[model samples]
Target: MLNKIKKQGFLNRISSLIIVQVIFVFAALFLIIFNYSTEGSVSKQINEVGKYQTISNEISGYLEDNISSLTTDNLRYEYIEGELASYDEILKAEILTTDKDNKLTPIFSYINSVQSVTNEIPQTYIESIAEHMISEFNKSNLKSQFAPIIYNTNNIINLLPLKNNQKTEAVLVIVSNHDFIISNRSELSYAIFLLFLIATLFSLLTVYLIFNRFKWPLNKLIYGFKKTARGELYELMEPEGDVELRALTSAFNEMSKTLWENSTQLKKSNDELEESNYLLSESRSYFKTLIEQSPDSIVVTNFSGNITFYNDKAGKLFGYKKDEIIEQHIDKFFTQPVMNTINNTDNELNGVELLAKTLDEELIPVYCIASSIEDDKSNDIAFLFIIRDISESKDFQEMMIRVDRYYTRGEMAGDIAHEINNYLAVLSGNLELMPLFMKKGQNEKIVSKLELMRKTVDNIARFANGLMDPNQDEAVFEEADINQLIENVLAFLKPQNRFDGVQINTDLSTDLPLVEFDISQLQQLIINLVYNSAEAMQQIEKEKVINIYTQPGNEGDGTVRVIICDNGPGVQSDKKEILFKKRFTTKRKGHGIGLVTCQKIIEVHSGDIGYEYDEGAKFFFDIPLKQKSKEKISEEEKASTVYGN
Candidate 1:
């Protein structure tokens, strides 16, 4: 072969080279087409497999529905059998159950057969389904579940786990003939193979004829290129071929002659373009990293409300990957109210509360603002939304309100009972002394106690009426003498509920001026604080004592100072900061709002309330002694508090 080629002319050698080149090119082409056709055949087989799986999915879904809605236990069995009959590909179907006695029972064709000893295959299939399906279903965050498919030679079988109304474990067995689907696809494969063969033969023939036409001209061009590679500038092609080849030869000669002239300019432009591309790629990567690492969840959406981009926080907030969430509707994460806010306006942002739904459909409270983005636009109007989770804030707010309500109710009950008991105490004490008064016909002590009791009853009626109508003001602020209010509270609460086992002692200063404060709130505040002290002391077996004191303005703010001292364990130093905070508890079952209520009531009356531990628990309050007019207090028909303690 080598001696014959050496003796051949340039045109003959070129013809032989063309034949060999055509064969190599056709061989590669044929190989590519053969691989493509093989892929197509495998794709058809995949479709066939999918068809069988689809029927199984349909049957499983039907069984699930029937199990949920059917009345009788056997109704679902009958319906499933009917569905199985319709699918010719499905060869047979049956239901299996594990009885309470660890026995396996086969329900064949709508009839439950005798219970048999535990069959390992059915239980194994159920466990396998549970093992694989649970993880796969959880990854998708989907509810529908099925076991991994069991493939046979020409058929498929699956034992799907199902639970009935009573949560009884059961398995549904389905057998399908996959060979039928494969047989239907075989004809398509043969036809594709035949077409492929015929096309390969025709393509090779056409390519051979086309190559013969360009063989001699291509040889001349190859010789010219070899000359140029060797730095032979005087070299040129004959330019005597076809129009296109002759034109290409002439252009090649001209390009070679001025190669160095334009090469520098071309290389400079190419270098700059490549550098610009590299810089642009780097900037894009930096921007993507910055977004992915952001703390706050940021989502960018197009005018059509599809997700264009989202940060890592956004993916975590939505329980999805960046790839999974892209092109998804923005409304999927937004609740109805948030949707209304964004869709209502054309281009406006309002910092509003919204609920975001995660992949598992859990709703989270979020504060988000959506505003239009001005950029290299691909849509009519794009939006950038910055979202922050506010679930903890909302939870804290709800807890505070609940604790406040509990303390408020306790205060109202305690104050009302204290006033009502004042009357009861007078009646019980005087009843024993009434025998002497009735025999002697004297009425000093009796008259004084009866008057005090009458006043207590009147106050109770006023308090009850105020509570009935919530809009009515319960406590009136006036120039209240501290000494007088202290005496009145003592008289009214002598037989208190929380102070039953406790002895109260008081030291009063008569020189203390009148302070502007609400009577009922002041009474409630004192009762709650005193009750708190008594309850704390109840745990100890000591003689419980509470001492009350009133003094002239002593805080340098011209405010009347009052103190309630108790012989009980004082609050811990570390825990004192939370004493005035709602929901902070120290006792085993305490609401921790009594001190908070005292703080609120003192603030309302323009006073300061605090706690300290010197000998024991010491509650102190300071109220301004500025006197105010009592015109409104006088106009009310309620009687002045008359008491003897």
Candidate 2:
């Protein structure tokens, strides 16, 4: 029990309370015992004094009664003296004596030295009383003689004088023992001490039991509180001992209940937070996957235009690997100093821009958007760029321009045909009349002139027939033999001396797969590129060669490649980026729509077109041999097939 209390830190407090209570009870008991002993002693003394007074009064009455029986003075004296003779026998006195006439005459001086109560009287008390009585008697003025008296062997003492007929006859004396006077007081004191000891023991036992009862509950309450502070769950304490402790236990139980509820709530909140974080991480991973797999070039950079991230498409489009571009400044990739233009002003360029060039000098028409991103700390961290390559869209626009030009030229050719037919008919009629009216010698000269006129008419008629055929239509896309297409295109452009002056070479692969394309558009594309190559090489004094090659590309997808290369002053590295842009021409007479139109036709057939300037200018385009089915058919394709059939 002691060890347990010490472990609980309650031993000191319990001991202190017990000690204090014990001290209080002991003090009260001590005071009660002291007061009882003192009061009893005083009371016993008063009772003893009352008993002695009563006995003394009784003795005086006896003397008075017996002395009255004497008729004369001598007889009274004689009677008193006779009474003193047996005073020790009557009163059990220790001493008795009688005197007469101031003389030391003992009428009845029975000292009874052997039977005297000298043991009962204190010697000092007897001596002092004897001296006092003797002095008083010596000074008395009574006619009787004075005498000293002591009784009970000096414990009690008194003096008496007897008289007869107005003369003092004799004096009587008695003494008491002091030992017998205080015997009762000693017994009373011993009894009081025993009672005090009993009371003190009872008080200590009661205090110990009460302190133990209170300490048990208080210690449990303290221990429970300490555990709660350490975040350990503890059971509610039950009521014990007194009413006050029970009430405190009830309140503590309620507090424990509230704490348990709060702990459960906190755990639930923590779980929810952890789940949300997990979901957020998954979402981020999904978004990253989408960005990496997209077909368009995507780049992310800091606010200062330093590249931070790029996807696979971005690497291919810019001809730079991801490792090369990452962490590089955007300015390193652009061939020209990108002008910051906004509202026709060159100053503000901090936002999104559309068209841009790449490190490989390829013109990438992009739909670019840029926005600033901030980190959790609210610091301006980076810029996010979403770029979509719009090169195919630009090519489509150029195709529309060519189609419009063709429509206009076809309309003008019809009017020219009608005018030319009328003039020819009139000229023919006049020629017939001249032949009938001419002499022989003049006939040959007129004939010669007539032949030249016939030749001019024939050429005009052929030109009109070519324009009036009305066979031109929108190019149709289908699988075609590439080698056959190339031969047909070369034959068509062979009429122009432009092809004859250029050293032309062909390396057509025999096993090249037939690719899906528009044959008419493909022919036009070849014509445009060959014409451009011939023009570029016209000024070069060296052997100017134009090489056209066809081969199966290494792309496992069975697509055929067509390559056109020229050994002329190759396209200027600086100008290569915008070469195919609409109206971007380097020549004075150049319309700038030729290469753009070629790019458009290739794209319409689900193919790609690109240029390179290593060693010499080279233009290549790849068309997939197999057609890919669209998920949905368009209204235009349906209408065209219906009309044509």
Give the best candidate by TM-score. 2
Per-candidate TM-scores read 0.36, 0.43
Please give the lDDT score for candidate 1.
0.64
Residue 252 of model 2: what lDDT?
85
- In TM-score terms, candidate 1 sits at 0.36
- TM-score, candidate number 2: 0.43
lDDT of 2 at 294: 87
* Alpha-carbon deviation at 416 in model 1, angstroms: 6.6
Extract clashing residue pairs from model 1.
none
Cα displacement (angstroms), candidate 2, residue 171, comes to 20
lDDT of each: 0.64, 0.61
In terms of lDDT, the poorest run of 10 residues in model 2 is 89-98
Query: Which whole-number lDDT from 0 to 100 does residue 352 have in model 1?
Result: 72
- Please, what are the lDDT tens digits per residue for candidate 2 over residues 241-359? 45566668888888888888888888898899889888888887888888888876677777677899998888877778887788887656454433232213322335443556776
**Number of clashes in model 2?**
14
